[model samples]
Target chain A: MKEDYKIERVKERINYIEDVLASVAAGDIDARINSEVEDDLSGIEAAIDLLIDDLTDELKQRKKMQKEVEEKLAKIQEQQKTIFQQQSDLLELSSPVSKVWDNVLILPVIGTLDSQRTQIMMENLLEKIVETGCTISILDITGVPTVDTQVANHLLKTVTAARLLGTECIISGISPAIAQTIVHLGIDLSSINTKATLQDAMIYAMKQNQLSENVKLHSLFADSDENEE
Target chain B: MLQLTTDSNWTELGKYIIKTEHDIVQVRQLIRVHAKEMNMGIIDQTRVTTAVSELLRNMYNYGGGGEVLVETGVVDDKNALIITCADEGSGIEDLDLAMSDGYTSGMGMGYGLPGAKRLVDRFEIKSEKNIGTTVRVMKWR
Candidate 1:
C-alpha cells in the first residue's frame, strides 16, 4: 500500500512538472515548479526552474537592446533633419535681397555661384521687384570667385526674366576674369546693361529714377498749363 | 533624324508640371534635393539643376507649359539621373538651327538648348511639327 501511495505521489509531481513546462512553452516565463521535498525528481525540478530563470533574463536583455537601438536610430534621423534645415537656412541667409535705394534693389552675391543658390537669389529678387515695384536691380558679384559659361548663362537668364517683369537688371562688379569668360563663351551682353562697380550701378539707378520722376513732373506741368490756357 | 528611345529599367523619382514661374522654382528645388540625395557634388548638382532650369524656361516661354520627369537609371555601369521634358506646343521646324548657340526664335539669349547640352552627359531631342517636342538629358554620377 505505501509503495502504491508513493507511486501516485511521484505521478502527481510529474504531471505538475509537465503543466509548468507547457505553460513556459506558451510564453509564460513566470511559471515554475515549486518542489519543496528533496528527492530524485527534486533535482530535475530545480534545474528546470533555473533554466526558465536564465531564459527570462536573456529575453529581457534582448528587449532592452532592441529598445536602445531604436532610440539611437531615431536620434540619428532627427539630427539629419536638423542638418538639412540648417543648410537651407544658410542658403537663404547667403542671398539677401535688399532695397538699397528708393527705386533700386540690390542683390549682393558673395561666394561661388551654384544653380541652387542662383535660383533662390533669382526668385527672391523677382519677388522683391514685384513687391516694391522697383525698376532697377543691381546684381553685385564682386565677391564671386569665378564665372564659368554656365554661370554667365544663368546671369543672362536672370536678367532676361527680370526684364519680362518690367525691371531692368544691371550686372555689376563683374571681375575681369568673368568678362573674359563671358566673351570667350561668345555670350552677348549687348542688350543688357553692365556696370563696373556697385557704386556705378547705384549712381546710374538713382539718375534713372530721378530722370523718370522729372519726366512725369514735366508732363504734369504741361497738362496743367494746357488746362489753364 | 532624332530617334526616340525608351529604357525599361529607369525608375521614376518625381514629376513636375511646368506652368507658372513658381513651378520653375519648385522644380529646381526638387532637382537639387534629388541630386543631393544621390550624393552628387555641388558643382555637378549646379550643372544638372541649371540645365533643367534652362529646359523648363524654354518650355514655359515657347511651349506655353510642359511636364518634367526625373528618373534614375544605370548607364555605362554608372548611376545616372535622367530628365525627360515633354511639351505639347508647336515643334521646331529645324532642330539643327534650334540647337545652334545664339539662334533663338524667341527673346532668349539662344543659349538654352546648346548650353543645356553642354552641361549634361547625354542629350537627345525629338520634335514633330504641330505635334510636340521631347527632350531627354542624362547626367552620370
Candidate 2:
C-alpha cells in the first residue's frame, strides 16, 4: 500500500513539471516547478528554472541591442538628409546672378566648374534673363582654374541658349590658360562673344545699351515728324 | 541590361542608380570622395570624376536611366579605380561613329563618349541594338 501511494505522488509531480515546461515554452518565463518537498525530481526542476532565467536575460539583451541599432540607423538617415540639403544650398549660393547695370546681368563664377554646377548656373542665368528681361549677361570666369573640352562645350551651349532667348551672353574673364586649353581641345568658341576681362565686358554692354537707346530716340523723333506732317 | 561581372580581386565600393540629373551630381560627389580616400592626386581625382560625370549624363540622357558600380582593384600591377555603367535603353547602332568626336545623335556637342574616353586611362564600351549598352572605364592611381 505504501508503494502505490508513492507512485501516485511521483506521477502527480511529473505531470506538474510537464505543465510548467509547456508554459515556459509558450513564452511564459515566470512559470516554474516550485516543488516544496525535497526529492529526486527537485534538482532537475531547479536546473530548468535557472535555464529559463538565463534565456529570459538573453532575450532582453537581444531586444535592447535591436532597439539601439534601429535608433542609430535612423540617426544616420537624418544626417544624410541634412547633408543633401546643405549641398543644394551651396549650389544655389555658388551661382549668383545679379543685375549690375540697367540691362546687364553678371554671373561671377568661382571655383572649379563641374557639369552640374555649370548646368545650374545656366538655368539660373536663363531664369533671371526671363525674369528681368535683361538684354546682356556677362559670365565672368576669372576665378575658374581650367576648362576641358566638356566644360567648353557647356559654355558654348549656354551661349547658344541665351542667344535663342534673345539675350546676348558675353563670356568674360577668359584667362590665357583657359584660352589655350580651349584651342588645344579644338573647341570652336569663335561664334560666341568673349571678352578678356569683366571690365571690358561691362564697357561693351554699356555701349550696346547706349546704342539701343539712341535708336529708340531716333524712332521717336521720326514718329513725331510724321505726325506733324 | 547586362549583369556586371567583377573579378575576384576587385572590391566594390558602392553602386548608385542614375535616374535623374541630381543623382548624377550625387554620384560624382561619391566618386570624388572615394577617389580622395584612395589617395589620388587632385588632378587625377578630377579626371576620374569628370569622366564618370560624362558617362552618367550619357546614361541619363540616352538610356533614360541606369546604374553605375564603382570598384577598386589592381590592374596590370597598378592600383586602379573602375567604373561600370549599364543601361537597358536602345543601344548604339555604330560603334565607330559613336566613338568619333563631333558625332552626336542627340543635342549634345558629340563630346560625351569621346571626351570621357580621353579623360580616363582605359575605356571599354559594348552595345546591342534594342537591348542595352555597358561602358567600363578604369583609371590608375
Interface RMSD of each: 6.3, 4.4
lDDT of 2 by residue, B44-79 (tens): 776777778778878888998899999999988999
- Candidate 2 ranges beyond 4 A from true positions: A1-15, A68-95, A108-127, A130-133, A140-158, A172-190, A194-229, B1-23, B30-45, B59-110, B127-133, B139-141
Task: Report how far residue B141 has shifted in candidate 1, in Å.
Answer: 0.2
What candidate 1 gets wrong by more than 4 Å, as runs, is A1-138, A141-229, B1-3
B-chain TM-score for every candidate: 0.95, 0.96
Clashing pairs in 1: none
What is the C-alpha local distance difference test score of each model?
0.85, 0.86
- Top candidate (TM-score): 2
lDDT, candidate 2, at A69: 100
- Point to the candidate with the largest DockQ: 2
lDDT of 2: 0.86
Error of 2 at B117 (Å): 1.5
Model 2: per-residue lDDT, tens digit, A162-200? 999999999999876456545533467899999999999
